[model samples]
Target: MTAPRVDYDRIRDVGPDRAASEWLLRCGARVRYCGQQKWTQDYNNLPTGPLDRYKIQAIDATDSCIMSLGLAHMEGLEHVEKITLSKCHYIEDSCLKRLSQLEKLQKSLLEMEIIACGNVTDTGILALQHFRNLRYLFLSDLPGIKDKENLAHLLKVALPSLELKLNLK
Candidate 1:
């Protein structure tokens, strides 16, 4: 049987699972985003220093449920400057819709990566067009994006100065 889903405090104590990371971030704990390989470990309690000293400026929720809980919880973090939601195969237009609500993302976010989000479509790209100041965007391995020409045109117009790394196959 599965254990009960812990609330915010238990999540902080455990540290670094998707749920725990999301929980800490929501509480303004400023947890750093380690890459996917070490994501499930309890790294928040390291002996290096006190956790409260670090302010979270970035989040890499790669292959995690950013379309749902991540987007919902991140709306309040005005300090978040970068986010990577790569390899989230099920993410779709709805994820972008949620991102639009994050005024923080529109203002402070400089980089975003949505690689391999195969379900994301042109509508999602349109939604991203709103981040006018976004400097860098990376999209790759998206099989569902068929209209490459339109997508490219839209990106050019929407993010005129954006540096893009696209591999939409």
Candidate 2:
């Protein structure tokens, strides 16, 4: 199947955080709002209060259908601190590139995990260098990564204080 299409008009109507939350949920991912304790997983039962009340702080896209094109929903998100991309078959190098280019995410994102995404290669992981404020990165089960040592070293050089863990084959 093709990747999910982004709705720019929805983003304009509901604001970035809510729009992104809807997109992520529709793609079978879970999202945590800035002050909410529970993860919102059900698209039909999305939290309702204020249009701008819920700010997306974390995303768990494990085994979801999230793709590179859908990452555009994150453009205006300013409070996203953590993201987990595990076993997302549609995720690829372009997804990482798109994520790294998000100026707001680059400053707010502190932790990320990429696991079991077969399409992600060293080129994609390397794109994370733009997240200068990222403090922790976990990578595992990504067989496409060929130069693990060099990629780790480069990331270390780019983000001196980052904590990186790799369990690649």
The number of the candidate with the highest lDDT is: 2
Angstrom error of the Cα, residue 136, model 2: value is 0.2
Scored against the true structure, residue 128 in model 1 reaches a CA lDDT of 81
lDDT by residue for model 1 (22-51), tens: 454433333454332232223455224454
Estimate TM-scores for all models.
0.69, 0.96
Query: Model 2 segments beyond 4 Å from truth?
Result: 1-4
Q: Worst ten-residue run, lDDT, model 1? A: 33-42
Query: What Cα-based lDDT does every candidate model obtain?
Result: 0.63, 0.94
lDDT string for model 2 (1-169, tens) is 9745789999999999999998899889999998889999999888888898889999999989988878889999999999999999999999999999999999999999999999999999999999999999999999999999999999999999999999987
lDDT of 2 at 22: 87
Candidate 1: regions farther than 4 A off: 1-21, 24-54
